[model samples]
Target chain A: MDYTFQFGVIAKHLPYLIGGAWLSLLLAFLAFWAGAVIGLLGAMGKTFGGRVLYRVIDVYVVFFTNTPALVQIYVIFYGLPDLGIVLSPFNSVLLGLTLNCGAYLTEIQRAGFQSVRREELEAAETLGMSLWQTVRYVIAPHIAKTLYAPLSNFYIWIVLGSSMAGIFAVEELTGRAINVSSSTFRTIEVFTYTAGIYVVLTVVASALLALIGRHAFRVKARIF
Target chain B: MIERIVDEIPRFFTWYNTIFFLQAMGVTLALTLIGCGLGSIFGFALVYGRQTRGRLFTPVRVLIVGYVEIFRRIPFLVLLFIVLFTTEGFGVRVSFFGIALIAICVISTAYISEIIRAGFEAIHRNQWDAAEAMNFGRVATLRYVIMPQAWKVILPPAFAYFVMFIKDTALASQMGVLELTRVAKIFNDRGYSAFLTFGTCLLLYFILSYPLTRFGQRLERRLASSRNR
Candidate 1:
């Protein structure tokens, strides 16, 4: 019954833990940007591409959304080698998360596109805007405005889900926690601190997003 | 391409023992059901405890808030690591399945509680007052006045969440549960084709999850139609 708590054990290891946190944030950051691009393209394809492209986009969206991100990661990480395209753990995890995020964001952005009015599209057309120009000048800003809140939510989801990078031994926050726990055998201390840092990261980033959303985009980004 | 596809079919089936897949499916179902089932019970307890402004329940309310806040904010993988490792370090011998099952239940409770509480919040304040006027006990009020409306709101999304949690079962495979993902990994270790092994794994998961996806969509449509009246 005498379980002495050792707060001291993990104190000096704080820097390593934070370094891992930084990696988690970095991975999510990179994946989000990459995914945003893919999503923009995929959404465009679904919205404007012919039937063939629409069906291709649909398959990607349905499969990626339904399956676990981990399995998707496994397929790209393992299955790609079968096709002679080998990716490093960093590349594999990044690619997998990006593809998954792309699928979700494609749907999110498609909703944004649907919300764009015909008058706006016609106005852009009257101004001699090319298709790309119309999308960039007309559709993009509106999507940013309407989609900011949901995108912020997805950003936090990515932050948490990126913890799976640890499973691949990617030396992220969860990976470092596993390392420290096994080394010090202070399982509770290590993971408690790790989990605390994750919360702090998610909260701080979400608050920043909410603020940007409220002030810059006028979206009601009411995140707790 | 036809020949390649045909070759892959046999390579895929080489690892396909109906019993093996069934066993993995069984564990996956067990994890999802136990987690969602007990989680809903405990989550309802949390919700009901929080609703009571009784002096005795104040600490419980605070505890419930803190529990949901922590578990919801933090990722489940970290919680699983904490539980699996902490229990092991303390020399509390248990199977990884036991540890993973508890972790999933605890983690899912936070999410399920949040969704349920959203349903709880949608009930009008006057409804509760009416229940009080009718001399309903707390349990009776929740059962009769509150939950029916909440269930109408909660059932569709809650079922979707359960489908999501079924996929989450694969995460427990890292803790060494022989779930579908882990089974595929085992076969991959035996020098089989990764495409066929994990590809079949993907197919099995698709088969398992696709119907739930349809059901969730149907529930939403049904709820929307029923609401319009």
Candidate 2:
């Protein structure tokens, strides 16, 4: 319990920590965007595609949702080399996170899509819209309206979950903090500073998302 | 090179290693159970505090919100490292188990409180009015009427949270606690078989959590059917 609170050591590592934070943010942003694409496709597949596609998406969601993301990262980072397809630490972690985020996003977006009333879809169809157009002009916008808050939360989740990437020596904020802690033995200071950075990053991310939602997805005034 | 490594798996599972693994599982489970128990108690307090809006309501609200934000915002590994080692600053010694339990409770309480609040919100105002019309005392109404229903509604979410709590306990390993994952990490470091070690840890977590997942699903289904009726 004899721990030193050495701010100097941590101060020296602040640049590294910030760099790590940037990389972590990059990882989350890439995963979020990639996952959104995967999500849109998977949602469509699950909701409207043939039975085989639906079942495949169902299993994908189940497997990813049921397992811990940490375990998935470990498996991807460590197990892939055995099969002769080795990945860099960064790619392995990114691949694990993107796939995992994609699964959860698929479920969330599917729920949003399902919530789009049948009447609205029919209205779009009656206007001579093609299947793709109907989905684009009708279902996608409707789902986006209902999904902003949950999507924001999911973004925060991936940000937080990215902390696990440090385990694979991806050198994110937590990893940098650990290195500082080991060298300086200032465990408390190192982690506290890192956690503060995390809090700031997430709060900023959430604010940005909220503003985007307000500007991009605002609809006509609600009677309620 | 790979053959030499693959050939040593059987020898790694010595009697001592197997015993340590089982003991580590026990530690992990114990920490999870203790955390969940404390979390439930604090969680209920939070939900009630939020609902009642009594004299303590504003402070309680602020406290709960702050608690939830701080824990949820912070990474689990950071919290684990701090709590596991920071006690001497207060001139008191705390064991690793104590720190792990406290960290889990602190984190889980926020989630459990939200789940409990959701349960409370799910109860219709009409149901509350009906209970009041029956001349039930506040205690009796909560115990016999509101609670049973809320408890049922919260079970699926609470059970899911419990599984999360179990999995999170693995992070205690970073603090040098002899938990399942830590033991696996040790074995992996020594054996240089990261695949086997992490793979085993993954399997252990699945073995522990999958049953809870099934139970939660069943409870959710039952709740859905009853609600429909």
Candidate 3:
């Protein structure tokens, strides 16, 4: 337990690590929005489409949700080359994460969809509201209120989850930490600093998300 | 590509390979179960420590809160590396499995403590007051009053987390743990088709996790119904 603390060396690379943190956020942001689109379609299909469509969406959700994201990325990154379709490490990881997030978001969004009461929709129609107006004024607010907390939580999860991109040699926060630690032989200090950055990064992200949720949707989501 | 995978299918699913995968699957299951089983106990202790009332225990409570907050925010991969390097720096010899297990336990304790806290909060304050009126000590109150009600709320989400950890333990592969994902990588490195190796790896994970997930959902539904009743 007599190891020396050498924060000085790692401190010099703080800017490099911060740059990697931005890349991590960027990765999570892109994948989350892309996944949200896929999730919305899956949720809509599950809720409103026929039995066949429901079963197909169910299978997709079940398979993706059950399997590990790392393996999914491996398949896309390594296996796809066999079929003459090569993607960069970043693209493969992005594709894998989007598909995985889509499955979980489908389940979350489906719950939100079901939370919309039939009577409320009927009341909106009775007020001579057109379909677009009904969706805009009535359905959107109800869905947003119910879904905001879970969606924000899921975003934070994705931010943490994007650390896996480092495995594929993508220069995200964890990857750069690996690089710095290897070069300086300061594995412990580098990783401890990386962990601290993750904590601060996620906390700030959570507070900002809570603020957005409060202003945009009036949902009282917690920052902590 | 399809034909190549098809050709490798029979070769890949040999008796030796099946045995290799099953053993690796067992490691995966053991890691999750043991790590989380320990985590639940430690998590309950953390919740209990945080619930203590007194100026003397204030630092203890603050430390508990800080531990849970900081650990929950770090990614599992970072935590794994930190644990690995910290142990090495201390000149302590630990197996990769041991390192992974420690990492899993740390993260799960943070998460499950929150779940346990929520479960305890779900119980009415009157229950605590009622126990106090009977002169029951804190341990007796938790044992006789709170736990009987709180476990119903805790079990489902805790089980869901357990199922989620099955997939997460895949990251242990990066440290060469010979778990399911590591085994898959070995096969792929042996020049097996990635589709055959990693795809099978994915299916094996699904087999391990899907049933537990379904059971957790059912447990939630049944518990909700019973709670209503």
Q: Pick the candidate with the highest TM-score.
A: 3
Runs of candidate 3 exceeding 4 Å displacement: B227-229
Model 2 agreement with the true structure over B40-147: per-residue lDDT tens digits: 899888776665556756887777777766677777777776776577454567777788888888878877888887887788888788988999876787788788
lDDT ranking from best to worst? Answer: 3, 1, 2
Residue A104's lDDT within candidate 2 is 87
Off by over 4 Å in 2: A1-16, A48-60, A82-86, A116-120, A218-224, B1-9, B12-22, B51-57, B125-141
The interface RMSD values of the models, given in order, are 2.1, 4.0, 0.8
Better of 1 and 2 by DockQ: 1
Model 3 agreement with the true structure over A82-116: per-residue lDDT tens digits:
99999999999999999999999999999999989
Worst 10 residues of 1 chain B by lDDT: B1-10
Model 1 per-residue lDDT tens digits across residues A1-224 = 33456979899999999999999999999999899999999999999999999999999988988788888888888778878899988789999999999999999998888889999999999999999999888887898887887788899989999999999889999989888888997888889999999989988997899889888777776667
Each prediction's whole-model lDDT (CA): 0.86, 0.79, 0.94
TM-score of candidate 3 versus the correct structure, residues matched by position: 0.98
Per-candidate Cα RMSD to the true structure, in Å, reads 3.3, 4.1, 1.2
Evaluated with lDDT, which candidate comes out highest?
3
